[model samples]
Target: MNPPTPSKPSPPSSSSYSSPQTLLALINNILSIVLLSSLTIKSFTGRWQVIHSKLTSLGSSLSSLSSSPHWSENPLLQSLLPSLLSTLQRLSSLSDCCSISSFSGGKLLMQSDLDMASNSLSHSLHDLDLLLRSGVLHQSNAIVLSHPGPCSSKDELSFFIRDLFTRLQIGGIECKTKALESLLQLLSDDEKSASLVAKEGNVGYLIHLLDFNNYGQNSIREHATAALSVLASANDESRKCVFEEGGLGPLLRILETGSMVLKERASAAVEAITADPENAWAVSAYGGVAVLIEACRSGSLVTQTHAVGAIRNVANVEDIKNSLAEEGAVPVLIQVLGSGATSSAQEKAASCLAILASSGEYFRALIVQQRGLQRLMHSMQEVSNSDTLEPVLRAISSLSKLDPSARLLSSSTTFIIQLGEFVKHGNVVLQQISASLLASLSISDGNKRAIGGCMGSLVKLMESPKPVGLQESAAEALVSLLTVRSNRKELVRDEKSVMRLVQMLDPKNEAVYSKKFPVMVVAATVGGGSSHGCRKRLLAAGAHHHLQRLAEMKVAGAHKALQRLSGNRIINTILGRTWRE
Candidate 1:
């Protein structure tokens, strides 16, 4: 028999050839061929040199990856293998063509092919490096072995977050979108995840996804912005990070052009980010004030609420207040107040208007001109909860600082009755604010008589030891109320009311409450042809000692009050002279 013929070596089948081990072997083979071609090819030696270097680096990375314990199990690597293999195969074919002695392709065509191959090789190398750096391979292996479910513990959740963040950095748009959805779900379900995202410095990646050009879909941007909103709402540090990472510009862009749902989500993010006073300028600097104002005018109620809230926070910065007014926020805010939006939205609009009104008379006049007072009064009647009522009352108080607003408010019997009720029964804050508003409204004589019905409540507030501002406010309001004859008569009729005012004039109480308003109140009560019995009641209330002390200290209205109390009695004249000395 002839020597047995050696069995012909068979070509590798498709499935086996595409296996991880086979792919690694094929990559090594192609890498060697490209290196040899780079050394020998003379026509485009420079291009080949660059291509060779890239392939060498890629080959080294592939070698290291193949040596990893779970290299075959890594989904990212498995998914990437086919494209990488195709690219390497094309690179090998181009190297072979360049090395051929008798090539038909033109010199320019050959040079172009070589340049394309070099770029392909460079891209492959970059992908491999990103894969190795991403830590996804090991994370996948660990995940598979442990089979983490639902992230029961912090460590487990951290592991899960790391995987999601890894995908966010390296995954394609679709992959990133999925990761963002999962991230938003996690954030919505668990408050701690936002803090973790901020701690891990992953906020920038989410912000990067906010760009529509990068993601190419509103869904992705919506999900990412919603996630950022939760993140910003959950943690102060995250809000700072969102602003510092330039999230405001993208958010404002969304407000400008995004769909209603997307704009709502972006507005929420802006609202959260601008909650910090330091971040307010970023919103204005990015021209967000106008965008927010427009959103307030035309966005959905939810969007308007968030936009108004963001404007409220942004207006906290003194410098941005003018910008907000210049951007025509006053009318839009007034519109929101009257548009039958949710009570929360109306409250935010009221608060934002309050801030703007406090900035200067221009914003105050602008708000009043737009019928803000009417809208605010309507809101006050519509909503009864303290939270909504507080801001509305504050806005009314701010606007009432303008005489026009005060005149408008003073005419509303409903407004005066509400103030009296709030002063008597509302929480301390409401009572203080209501008392202050009464003082503001009392600038009108009609208001003083209307507010006089609340004199009993005001007197009770002054007698309370806490919140000296409330005491001062009630005193000022009483001063205005006493300018009318009926209010002064009513005060002396209630002896305790006179006692409270007299008590407020004590020198020791000066540090607790200002003595000027009380002195002014006493002067108003006794001067301008008041009854002698009222003076007797004030003298009997031990007002002489407090007024003498205040007079020595030269508190405004004190000496005049003392003289008014002294009046033409020989004993009073001698006593007043001794006190004056």
Candidate 2:
């Protein structure tokens, strides 16, 4: 942020005297005083020079104090807040009492006295913030906003707010030069106040203020951008307001026009809009997908996080998913999961992978083999926080949707067992969701003994005294494991397990089965892969004849089961070796 640079003071005003000649005379007297001081300094070589030097140094300190931030922790400076508040006769006094007419012919009036305006405004905001820290935020806010000080009006009230922000932008811009610090303070304020200024519709104003060549400083521009992040999430009505007001395009333009911070803020705003699923498609339609992907792939960590967040919000809906998926986001997100190890980046990549994986079978394979599952599991160890933990959740959720990703028994078992541990660690959400993923993995692939090892736990969960949600999730999990073509006979062989499942399917039992089996033939084939003797048991038990009838009818389950069975040369040859009776 640029500090306000000093320049030579202007000549005395013409109104100094009743006429121009008097002003000229006063100016001449001042010039003579300066000339005498120079001559006297020349006369006294060392002593006079030292005294002159000290006075000059004091003047410089005073000047810096006038415009520079109060540093020193000086009690006097700290006392200014309450002192100014007591002195302010009214809020209207915050402006110098000037008016400017807008192009729309609206009049904007300033209410505070010119001299104390900036100082008073700063103190007011500072004191209010202090009050809130003391825990009277709600009551204090109501009182302050209600104080119709001469500066108050719904329309005119905005001027003080704008003034406070502008001075904040300029004041901090002039010092350590980071107005972002102050802006973020406002941002971290409760959602209520952040929404107030954001909903007030100054987004376009803030965007315009972000010009790269602006005098105050880039840091000030950065602060404005920070403020925009809060505004973008102010409310749905407000987000649309920002969008319709053309704030969306200009805000996004910052992705290319501003610094890394600005880019992240702009990307974040786009994400905030996508949070409302209704606007998710609109974001894609408005060409934000490329911007989001560009940000996701190459932008800073902030941009990547927000970009991935936007993708996650949109991926839940169908058409929106195609839009995000089309922009080559899948490969980019996969790359983020690879190259970036930040918590947020990992989280987003996990979720995006889940969304894409669930879209179809090919996508499922794409996510699993394209190195998604491995990285997702790895991320669980890299970062902390609820958000970082979420991608694993989504990975599990998508696993439910996709079927399976790992082909090797070792890899699949490791991931499944790790997930079960997370579920057992006591997050019901994780438990239910993990159960769903385990179900998908078990049913989707040939890893049954692993499922069998957990069969007791799963079966017990199936009969647990949990809430309906847990019950439903447990049942779905069991179905996921049981849905594969091969598990049926083993589940049946236990007789007790089969009877339990049969009872689950029976209306006579208090418990309900979804009644929809994924595909019994698929289950049978999956069952066949579970053990050495299981396939022989099913065939010897007349399962092959039963399956042949299903194939004639073109049942999906039978088709898959036959395909798995057909792959075995011994089985094919033995079946072919048979002579018709």
Give per-residue CA lDDT, model 2, range 81-132, as digits (tens): 3333233322222211221112222223321232344454444445433332
- Give the Cα error of residue 48 in candidate 1, in Å: 3.4
Q: In order, what lDDT does every prediction score? A: 0.75, 0.53
Q: Cα deviation in Å at residue 1, candidate 2?
A: 62
| Candidate achieving the largest TM-score | 1
Model 1 agreement with the true structure over 243-320: per-residue lDDT tens digits: 787788988998889888889888998898888877778876787888988888888988988988998888878767
Q: How well does candidate 2 score on lDDT at residue 275?
A: 81
TM-score of each: 0.83, 0.51
TM-score of model 1 (CA atoms): 0.83
Give me the candidate number with maximum lDDT: 1
